[model samples]
Structures are given as C-alpha cells and as structure tokens.
Target chain A: MLGVTLSRWTMSYFAAALAALLAGEVLMTAGYGFPSAPLRAPETLVVVHVVAIGWLSLLMCGALFQFVPVLIARPLHSNTLPLPALVLLLAGLGALLAGFLQLAGTLDPAPPLLPVAAMLLAGGFALALYDLARTLWPAQPLPLPARFVAVALFFLATTVTLGMLFSFALTTGLGSRPLLAVAGAGLPLHVVAGLGGWLTLAAIGVSYRLLAMFMLAPELEGTRSRAVFWTGTAGLALTVLGGVAALSLDAALAPALIGGSVLGVVALVLYGADIVHLYRARKRRIIELNSQMAVFAFAALAAAAALAVTLIVLGRLSEQVGALVFLIAFGWLTGLGLAKLYKIVAFLTWLECYGPALGRVATPRVQDLVVEARARTWFLLYYLAVASATVALLMAHVLAFRLAAGAMTLATLAIAAELIRARRLVDVSAEIRLPAGAQRPHLLMSVPHPSP
Target chain B: MTQDYLDLDVRPILRDGGEPFEKIMEAVAALAPDQGLRLYATFKPIPLFQVLGRQGFGYAAREIGGGDWEVLFSRADIPAETAPAATPASATPSAAGASDWPAPVQEMDNRELEPPEPMVRILAAIEEMRPGEVLSALLCREPMFLLPELEKRGHAWRGGFEPDGETYKITVRVGETGDKA
Candidate 1:
C-alpha cells in the first residue's frame, strides 16, 4: 500500500468509537435500571457517559485528529498522542463504569474508582487537546470552523475539570464547601457546557465547512456564519458565568440563564437558515444518501430547540429538560454522526484501497464503495426508531422506550456491518467489475488493485 | 511585433477581447496537422500556454500593436524556425470547430469539504474531460484517496502543499501523463 498522510492511529479511533456506540445502544436496549432510573441515577449516568464520552467524544476526537491538520493546513504536532489517549480513555471508561455500578449497588466493593478514572480520562483529553491546539496555533485569523473548534476544546477542558472535581469531592471527601457549592447550584450547568459548548458548537463548526463543501455551494462565510459563532459563544459564556456565580456566591441567576437560552436559540436559527441556503444553492443537482439523511438530523435539532422553548415559555422547563436532552443526544447528535459516518467509512476505504488508481484504468468511485441501496433503508429505520424512542422516553413509558431501543439497536448493527464490509474491501461480494477502455468511472466490486 | 506570419490575422474578431472563446477555439481546431494557429489578444494568456502545451502544441508570441499580443500556436512536430500560420482570419460561418486548444482542464477547490465530496467532484469532472485536458484541485490536505484512483485509471498526477502549508494543489492530466507529470 502507498504511504498515506493521515495519522496512523486515526482509524483506531473510529473503530473504538463505533464499538462503544454499539455497546451503549445495547445497554439502552437492556433496560437494566428501567423506570426507576432518574436522570442522576448511577445507571443513567453510566449510559450517558457511555454515549457521550465513550462513543461521541471518541468519534469526534478521532475525526478532529484526522481533520484538524487538514483544516488548519499544518502537519500534526504529534502523531503519537492518540495511542496514549485512546488507552487512557478506554481504561478510564472501564473504571468509571465500575464505579457507577458500585454506586447503583449492583457491584459490591466496587472501590471508589471515580476519582482515579476521572484523572485518567482528564489526562487522555489533555493530551489530545495539546495536539489539536498546537496544530491550530499557526493558522492565525483562524477559519470559522477552526475558530469554533478552538472554543469547543476550551469547553471540553473545562467540562473534564469540573467532572474530575466532582469525582474528587465524592471520593476523597475534601473540598466539601466547593462540592456543596456545585451540587447546590445544580449540575445542569456542567451538562450544558459539555453538550452545548463542547459538542454542539464543535459539530456546528465542522458541519459548516463539510456541508457547503459537499454540496458544492459557497461557504457560509457571510453574516450567517458569524451570527452563529458569536451568538452561540455569548450564550455559552453567559451560562458558564452564571454557573460560576451560582456555585460560588449561591446566587440564583435565573434571568441570565433564560437570556442565554434565548441567545442559543437565535444562533440555531441562523445556522439552520444557512444550511437551508446551502441546500438550495448546491450545484450537484442530485443529493447523495448520507447528505439526504443528515437533513433529518438537522430537523431533529430544530425540533429539540422548539420543544425546549415551548417548555420554557410554559414554565415547565425543569420538568421537560430531560426529554429535550434526549432528543438532542439521540435524535440530533447521534443522527448526524450516523449519517456522516456512513459516507466517511466508504471514503476512507477508497483512500486505503484505490485512491491512486484514478484516471488510470477502471476504478470504483467512492460512492460505489458504499452499498447505499441497502444502507439507505437502515438510515430510515434508525431515524424512525430514534423518534419513537425519544417520545417514549419523554413520556416515561419504559416498555415503549425498550421496544424502540431494540429496533434502533438492530438498525445500528445492520449499518455497522455494511461499514465493516466496505472497510475490508468485501464489496467484491457484489461481483461488480469495470472493463478496460471505460469512458466513465463508477462503482464496482472494490478489490484492491495496485496502482500502475 | 515582426510579421513573421500574417497568413491569418484574428485581430478583427478579437476586438471584443476574445469575445467568443468558442470562436477562438474553432479557429484553433481549423489548423491542419501541417499548419499553425495565430491568435491576437490583449494579454499574455499565460494559462492557455499550459492548456495547449499539454496537447503537444507550443507557441511563440510577440506584441503586435497597442497592447495586442499575436500568439502563434503550432504543432510542436512542425520545425519551429520556418513553419508559419496560413488560415484566413474570416474562416467564417464557423460551426464551433472541435476545440483544437487542448481541452481546458477544469480547476476546483475542495478545501475543508467533507471527505468523499472532493473525491466525488474530482472523479465526475475527470469522467467528463476530453483527452489531453487536465484538472487541478486545491485541497485542504493531500487527497490520499485520489492518488490510487488516478493510478488505476492510468492518469498520472503530482501534488504538494503550496508554500502556505494549508493549500495543497494536485494536477491530474486525463488519458495520459502528457508532459506535465
């Protein structure tokens, strides 16, 4: 194989993340904690962290490690960082899961591993951040996407710090005042920082570039992109500041929180409009399946936003925040991840196997690497299951959530299988081949052929 | 410029500054294998040099009068010192002559585009290119995916990041390596 410029461990990140996603989805389907699982219940915490840290964060980190250099036009400062980080993360996740199970009384003598796990996870993230930050440093007047990612990294560092602090207080029994401070002021602020500032903001930044480029439309470098960036930043800033004030001074910053939430919504609207414009402006007349399905992910985000606003307006915000989060995580964030992954796998596979064969003889295009006709149906099924599961979880119907999760788990596994097939160059199973003197290149059974 | 060859004066048709690119191309294609093409333009036409050169054509140019450049593109096979242009400027009622200029290679930028889109666009453009044309793309990173595809199709390519490390440029010539590779 020709030497590839991408990070050596990049695919390992994807493989690890996908494995975690499958485990997390299966956990949800198992319904071990059931109706008794409150938002803060140890079992619930296990599931949340499994999805957030183990799956989504890992996926994002892998992608960023690969794309950050590409985005900033710099070679990675350190290629070795991912291996240690991956090891630390997976190890920390195991410890954290055990600690949570102990808290839930499912594991006797689980040994207070939260603080230890927290430190390991923090170490892993810190190392990852160092590599990304170094790459970003040389690209001054950073592109809009890089700008967003920079802020998201800062938020991620903060999120991990706070989480470690929480674990430290619980395990070591020190800093009682600070521990009480955070617990009293509420931990929703922490959740918001991770989900809103770290995850969503970064996703928005990445998609801004990806969507426009993929659609063959002009980048949203105008007012709309700026609007999303600034407003989203301001909203997150307000929330973080308010959380600090509440924790330290015991002040209730309700009005500031509301103001922040409204600003966040405004940012979302601008971003949504920008995306719609991109779709309309696309020169590629036909939309591919991955992009077509990503529309639903965006719609899911919009729906979640609308629900949050309605709950806030009706004075039932506290009661419904959980449901809104569910929608955002499973419906919006995971949906986008799945949709994008479907295409990304095929692309990476093509690069691995057949990239240099272009314009030479007959070679399969990237689209041909994907069995989209089969995978496309899975996308629909996954989204449908997500919607049903979201509604059931919101309605607090345990049985319904379980049923929907089962369907989702199955759909996810089916799609994942296709990804594996593509990665291994098993598309040869389709028995398609391109003959000599072909005027146009298209998909066929992708057997790896050495470039002439 | 010295009138080494005034067999075809395209100056009248170029008054609108290469008004019809198609017409310019048609005048080019009309040149017989033994003949050459003379074009009058206001500027250097530097990009066209590369475009036509890839098709086994070479040119010598000199200023005619008042900023007009008279460029004579001829088959490189012709002994350059004596071969001269012969087509009349008003070779009129011209149907769009097949483009004699090596097909213009399309250039695209796919920096920061999601994976596969860049690959998709490049492949699509390559499929549509006529023989001898090239396509150059500016990318955010080295297109690791494109190299193999190019090799398998027998098209040759070379790329490297620009001096500004962020901009990567790759050039692919369709059907053959031509001279650029």
Candidate 2:
C-alpha cells in the first residue's frame, strides 16, 4: 500500500541519536572507574562527538523530513527510501559511536571502524539530501525558509566530509607536526557547520514560518528577514573559513579570523534579537513549554558566543572556555532541540492521524495528546540540570558533574517518554477514526500552539 | 446574441490596492442599463468569502479546484441567480446580455433554454453538499481558482477551507445530485 511510510532518514537519525545518548551515558559511567584525569580526555571527546554528530544531527534531519513538506506546500518527494536510509544511518551511528568509545579506552579498535562508519553516515545523508533536494529543485526563486534549509544542506554535506577527513587523519595516525593537520583544522570547521550553518540557520528559517503561524503574527518576510538570512550566512561562512585558515597558515590568516568572528558575533546578536521580537509580538499570551524552554536555550547560546568572543580577544581558550563551549553546544543547543522535538513529534502524529478528519468529522485538539503542565515541569528540570552541570564543570567537581549528568539523563528520558505518548504510535492507523464523544465542530480548524 | 455577452469585460476596483482589482470593481460598478456585471474573483478561504457576502457584495462561490474558489459577483446588491433559469433565454433580461459576458462564462449563452453548462458544472457540484465536501476540493494542490466566478454569480456558504489537519477526498462527480462519495 502506498501509505505514509515512516521516513527512513528520520528513523536512521533517531537511531543514531539514541546510540549517541547511550554512549554519553557509558562515558559518564566510565568516569567513575577512571577518576585520575578528566579534562581533555579521549572519553570526553567521544562524549562530545556522540552528542554533536550522533544526537543533534539526527534530530535535525528527522524534523526536516516531516517539516519540509509542510513548508513547501507539497507531499514528501518520496516515501520509498525512508527505511533503507534509516537502517544505513542507524548502523553507521552505531559503528561510529562504538569507534569513539573504543578510542577513549587505553587500547583502541575504533581506528579502523571510524572511516567506515563515517562513510556510511555520509551515504545516508547523501540519499536524504537527494530526496529533499528534489522538492526544492523545481521551485523558481524558492521561498525564504526553504532557501535557508536548502543551503543548510550544503553545509551539512561539508560538515560530514570534514568529519570523515578527521576520522581518516585519526585512523592514519598523523604526527603532531604534520604539514596539514586535518584533526586540528577540522574541529572548528565541524563546529561552524553544525552550530552556525546547520542549527542556527535552519532554526531561523523554521522559526520564521512556525513562529508566525503559532503566534498569528505577520509573516516573517520582507527586508529584515532577508537580512537575517544573508548576514547569518555570510558571518558563519567567514568565521569557519577564517578559523580554518588561521589554523593552517598561522599569523597570515589572523585578519580573516578577527573579521569573521566579529561578523559572526554581530549576526548572532541580530538573530537573538529577532527571535525575541517574534516572541514578544506573539498573539498568544501564554507561551507553550517548548517555546518557554527554548528562550533560555537561545539566551545561553547568545551569551556563550559573547563570552567566547571576549575570551578569544583576551587569549583565554583554556579548559574553562572549552567547558563553556561544551555547555552551549550540548546543554543549550541540544536542550532546545529536545524541547522542540517534544512538540514536533506530537504535532506530526496529530497531522497523520487527525488531519484528514477535520473537515469530514470531529477530532480531538492537539492538546489532547499530552499534558502541557507536566511538559513544563520537565523542561524546567532539564534546564536546571544543564545549569548545574555547567557550574560543576566550571568548578571541576567530578562528583557534582556526574550527578548533574544523571539529572540531565533523567530529564531527557522523561521528555522522550512524553514524545512517545504524544505520538500514540500504538493507536494511530489508516482508519479515519474520531475521538470518543466528538461531534463535527464547525469547519474551522483549531490553531496549533506556537512557540513563546 | 452569444457575441454580446462574450465581450463583457469585468474590472474590479480593489478597496485601494492595485489597478486590476480597482479597475475591475469600477467596470463592475458601471453596468449597462438593465445589464449586471459578473465579477469573478477566487476566494481560497470560505470565511473571507462569507465575510464578503455579509458586506453586501453578493456572489456564488464554489470550490472548483484545490482550496481555490470561483466566486461570481454582480453589480446589483441582490445575490447571484442561485437557481438556473427554467424559462427560455429569450424571456430573461440577463439572458439577453449573456452574449456580452467573457468567453468562458458566456460559452453557453447561445442555449439559454438550458443552464450555462460551465456554471452548471461549477454550481451543480457544490449546492446542498456538506461544508466538508465543499472545502475538501478547495484546499487541493490545484485549488479551484474558478470558484470565484460562482460566488460572483451570488451563492452563499458557512465557514472556510480550514487546514484542520483533515484529509478530504476530492474528485469529479458525474451526477446531478452532486454526490461524490
């Protein structure tokens, strides 16, 4: 049956993300065994990669799989490839996280597997890109949000390639004094690709449409919206290129790094302000849990960027700076991502099951899927955990850090459980069913809740 | 006689937006003595279409394709002739001017004894059907933009083509009862 197949890309991405989460847990647990040294450790790098590449990357891809069609005003390009793509990404993530965990240990079997796993992940992404690109390719002068997503795909591709390059370098055991040190140069490139190009840009584009729809505000178009896209795009490109050059060419690229960072910081500030403006202008007075939690994450991101800029100017990218960067990347960016996922999963399930019956018959509102009050509390607890971890990491308190990690794990698990409940996968089917005791309300579709 | 209504150009003056709209409205306002101007404008949202109806501009709006509407407007404040004329064309005053209408709406002006086939195609599908049936076809990818012509002819309905997250089946109905299911 040509039904709405579960998106292969989404499945794969989620699988990888779950594997990464498990790896993070394992690394934290292992910390208890190896308590001598924790800073700049291999295990730490493994945990970071698991969260960055494995977790967040998948989450973004899965979301795009669902949301892109809605944005473009079309059905998904293809439903056929989701399962294969999901399997490939899941297997790749499994191998990749395993390799990282092995590398973290004293004796390593991770080296050989890294390149293979990278290739598999890259292949999975490539297939997904092709499918998504089909949706965008035919449109003349693609819409604002879609354009951002299209361009972000390129950055995603670049990020994957750079990730592979780093894996190759590690596998080959390049000396500390190599002419072109891929690992050293590629780390910042990965950060740029993920944080600026993929997450920030994609998030802005999505927020423009979603926020407006949610808030019942005017469309986020016209000159200022365009400026946000171009400025953010240019800034991220410049910063990534400049940082890469600085590493490869020493003082020769110092000017580029300085200029790029400034541009990047400026763009980020504008984006932050824009998000705040959107929230402020919202017609809905009471903010939902996803949006409310996202505001703190957004603030943390902007603050971290500002702090990083200051530290870089004063030449203080020491362990403390690294810890802060970790918090922003994982705690802020990933936390916001998780919060948003809770809403998205529920919303999509509603569309799949209840969207068709809106005109013909009565259906339950999206609110019926989950309890909002509980969601708000979970979000608050998640942020609390993030804040405590950040402080513990700063103070170099190992015991406190572990406890905070446990708290984060609990919060994330709770949110994931809530997502499953919202989806009601066990209950959803092709049959056009109505909620119990429902009458055909007037043809007006109730508005889905917006971000704060 | 068909040639007379075939050339009737409609220009609506938008409240104050652009030439096409405003000119169209002005053209509609300046109807020939004893002749009504039929203005066709698509309304994708039924609520907005109904709002226009409440504002004294009567029309017959039908969902022809996608979420698009084909609403028909007349210069007079009265609703567009909802029921097709049962009498011979020679007897109806508007039928005498049917020849002056645009080609598509006037294609059947020669045979006034029967309802305009295109108008019949548009209105026959929607009249007395459920609101959901009307809206299902309205929101399709290839929305019924021609529905405006129907509204311009003076039909009324409740509600809009809401994105209620519902899926409706839209297809060509082959019978007079307007039953698609």
DockQ of each: 0.13, 0.03
lDDT of each: 0.72, 0.56
Model 2, A98-174: lDDT tens per residue?
Answer: 77666766456734788888889888888778877886676647788888898788888877877777777778655
User: In model 1 chain A, which range of ten residues has the least summed lDDT?
Assistant: A438-447
Model 2 chain A: worst 10 consecutive residues (lDDT sum): A443-452
Those runs of model 2 whose alpha carbons end farther than 4 Å from true positions after fitting are A1-19, A22-26, A29-40, A105-111, A173-179, A245-254, A425-452, B1-181
Lowest-scoring 10 consecutive residues by lDDT in candidate 2 chain B?
A: B106-115
Please tell me what DockQ candidate 1 reaches: 0.13
Highest-lDDT candidate:
1
